[model samples]
Target chain A: MSTTQPHKKTSGAYRHGDLKKALLGAGLALARQGGPNAVLLREVTRQVGVVPNAAYRHYANQHDLLQAVRSAAMSALANAIESELAKLPSINDPADFARANLRAVGMGYLKFAQDEPGLFLTAFSVPDDLQGTAVPEKAGNSGLNPYQLLSVALDRLVDTGVLPNERRMGAEYLAWSAVHGLSMLFIDGPLRQLSPAQRQIVSQRLLDMVEKGLV
Target chain B: MSTTQPHKKTSGAYRHGDLKKALLGAGLALARQGGPNAVLLREVTRQVGVVPNAAYRHYANQHDLLQAVRSAAMSALANAIESELAKLPSINDPADFARANLRAVGMGYLKFAQDEPGLFLTAFSVPDDLQGTAVPEKAGNSGLNPYQLLSVALDRLVDTGVLPNERRMGAEYLAWSAVHGLSMLFIDGPLRQLSPAQRQIVSQRLLDMVEKGLV
Candidate 1:
C-alpha cells in the first residue's frame, strides 16, 4: 500500500488490536450501502468511533482499505460457494461429480449475488491503483479465494474427462464471464426488475449454457 | 429523469442552439476520461465555457444529462457494430448470414469497449430515472441502438432456424452476458494485462463458446 505522511498521534496504539477488525466491519457496511465509493478510511474510522488519525495504522490510505475489503469479499464469496456445495447430494459417478461441482460454483456465485448484492459488487471493484498490495490470492478463513475455488472446480472437469485437455487453457475465463455477467445483469441491469422466481429460472438457464459450452 | 428546480436565469435562450450539442460532446469526453462519475452537469458546462446555471436549459439535472449521454452511447455502440459488419463478406445461405451477423454484433461490442472503455461503460450505466427520453428503440442514423441491434441479430437466428424455437425466449440475455462479461473482464479485471493480439484470440474463443451454447 502507498504510504502517506505519518499521522501525528502519540496515542496511536491506545486502541485495542480489535480496531482493525472493527474498521473492516464498518467498511463493509459502507460498501453495502454505497458500493466501492463509500469505502473511505476516514468514514470507516468515524463509524468505528476512533480518531481519524488512527486509521493510518491499519490502512495506509483508501486504496489499502479497499484491497482489504476486496480480500474479505473474496472470502465471503468462497464461503457462500462452500455452503451451496455442502447441501448437495453425494455424487455416485465421476462425470456427474464434475458437472455438479462445476454447476455448484455458478449457482453459488449467482445465489450469493442475489443474497448479498453489495458484497458481490465489492468483490470485483478493482481500484485504479493497488499500490503493490497483492490481491488476496491467499485463502482467508474460508479456505479459498474466488479464483482458487473456480480453478479447482475446472480442474475436476478435466479430471473427469468432461472437458478435453486441448480446450482447458482458457476455460475458466469463458465460464467466469457468463456467470459474472448474469449476476451483474441481475443486480444492476434490466434484469433487476425480474421477480425472484424469474431470476432463479434465468440463473439455471445461464448455468445450462455454461455447461454446454464448456464440454 | 429526475426534476430539479428550474434555473432562475432570465437569459436562458441567450446562447445559440449549438449549446446542447456542445454540452453532450463535452459530456462524452468526460465519460471517456472517467466513466460515469466525471459526467457532472456543472463540469460539462464549465468545459463548454457556459454559466453553470445555463445547463438547465439543455438538461434538467445530472440524471437528465446522463440519460442523454447513455442514448448517445447506444448509438455509438450500434455504429461500431455496423462498421465491423460492413467489412464482412456477403453470405448467400440464411444460416450463414445469421451466424455471421450474430458474431459481428459480439465482435463489435467487444471492439468498441476496447477502443472507448469509458464511453462503453457510460452507455450501460443506467440512470436513476428515464422518464421521457427517446431511448434508441427506433433506428437512428447508425441504424440501431445496442439492444435493438442485438434483438435484430437474434431474430435473424430464429428466422433462419439456426437456433431452436424452444431456446429463444431468454437466449439474448445469455448471449449478452457472455459478451458483456468478456468485455468487462478485458477492460477492468485480470484480463486487462492481455496484449491486443492475445485479446483477439480470447475474443474469438468466447464467441465460439457463445455460438455453440446458443445453438
Candidate 2:
C-alpha cells in the first residue's frame, strides 16, 4: 500500500502535479459556502493561488470543475451510508436487516443534506454527461454506490423470501421514492415544519412501510 | 356569480394598483427564459419600463418579489389541475374517480415542471412565511389545497372500504412520496433518458402501485 501523508507538497503553484485535486477541493469549499452557482473557474483558481488559465490544465471549464466537486460529494454521501451501516448489529433475519439498512441510509442522506446543503444540491444537480465521467468506480471495499446499496438490500429481501423476485424493480422504486422524496421535502419543501425529532419519527414510519410492503 | 375585475390604476411610472401583478408577470417571463436565478427586480422593472425605485413600492426586495412570482405559478398549477379534473368523464365509482383525479393532478404537475421549470421550482421553494401570504385563497371551494386534493382521493379509498381511515396519513404520505419523487426524477434526475412515452408508462406504473396499496 502506498502511504499517503496528510499534507504532501506539490510542485510550483502553476504546474502543481496535484492541481486537479486542489481545484476540486476549492470547488467543493465554494459549493459548501454558496451553491452550484458559486463554483466559477476563475474564482476557484484564485482560491488555489494559481492563474486562471492554469486551471484549464486540470478542468476544461467551470462545468468540469463543478462535476468533479459533485462526484466528490456523492462519494462522501456513499461513505456516510457505509459508515452508518457498519454501526448496526448483525442480524440473522434478512427483513430486520433491510429495515435497519434503509433507516441508516435515509438518516445518513438527510444528515448529509443538513450538514452540507451545497454539496448535497450539487451532487444531485450536476448534468448527466459530467456525472457519467466523474462518479468513482463502484467496486472494491466500497461494495456499493447509493443505488446499489438499496438494490442489494432489495436483493437480500428476495433471497430470504421476504419479497418475490417479480416485485424487484417495483419494490426498489417504491423504497427509493419514499426515502428520496422525504429527503427532498426535508431539504426543500414544506416538510420543514416538522422538528428534528418529528422528522426522525416520520423517516422511521416511512421505512417501516417499505419493509412491511416488501414482507 | 360576481364578475368583477379589480382595475385600480396608478399615476406616472408607479403603477400602484397593479404594480405587484405587473412585477409578477415580468418576473415569470424572466424565469421562463432563464430559470429562477434570472429573476431580478431591476430587470423586471426595466422590462416594465418603470423606474427601479418604483418596484420597491410594490416589492420590499427580490425575495418578496420572487415569493409573489412563486405564488402565481402555484395558482396557475392549481387552476390547471382543476381544469383537468373538470374534463374527466363522470364515473359512478369513487375509486375510479380517485384514480382519474390523481392521474390528472400528476400530469398537470409534470406539465408545469416541463413547461415552467423555474417557476415550478420557485413555487415549491419559497419560504413558508412568504408562501402563506401569497398562496391564493379558494373561498367556498370545499377548502381545496393541492395536498387536500390528494387527501380527498384517499378519503374515497376509505369510503370504498379499500383502506382503513386510521391509515389515511400513512397512505397519503406514501402516495405523495411516490408521485412527488417520480416528478422530481423526471424533472431533474437521470430519468431524462426515457422518451416522453416511456416516461408516461413509468408514471402510470407508479400510480398503479399507489392504488394497489390501498387494496
Can you give the lDDT of residue A130 in candidate 1? Answer: 24
Error of 2 at B189 (Å): 1.0
List, residue by residue over A1-215, the lDDT tens digit for candidate 2: 35643343365333466888988899989877666667788899899887898888877777777777877777777777777778889987877786677777767766776666676666766342222333334322386677777677677777777788887777777677767677766666657567888777777666666665654
Model 2, B13-121: lDDT tens per residue?
3334577677789998886656566788899988877777787887888878877776666666666566667788988887777667777766665666666666565
* Candidate 2 Cα misplacement greater than 4 A, ranges: A1-19, A37-57, A94-104, A126-143, B1-19, B49-54, B95-104, B126-144, B155-161
Give me the displacement of residue A42 in model 1, in angstroms: 4.5
lDDT string, candidate 1, A1-215, tens digits: 35654444555645455788888899988876666767888899888878887878888887878778877876888888878877889999988998899888889999998788777777766455321333457463457876677778889899989999888856777788888888877777667888999999988888898888887
> Each model's number of backbone clashes?
1, 0
Candidate 2 chain A minimal-lDDT segment of 10 residues: A126-135
Error of 2 at B19 (Å): 4.5
Model 1 / residue A68 / CA error / Å: 2.4
lDDT score for candidate 2 against the true structure? 0.68
- Model 2 quality (TM-score): 0.77
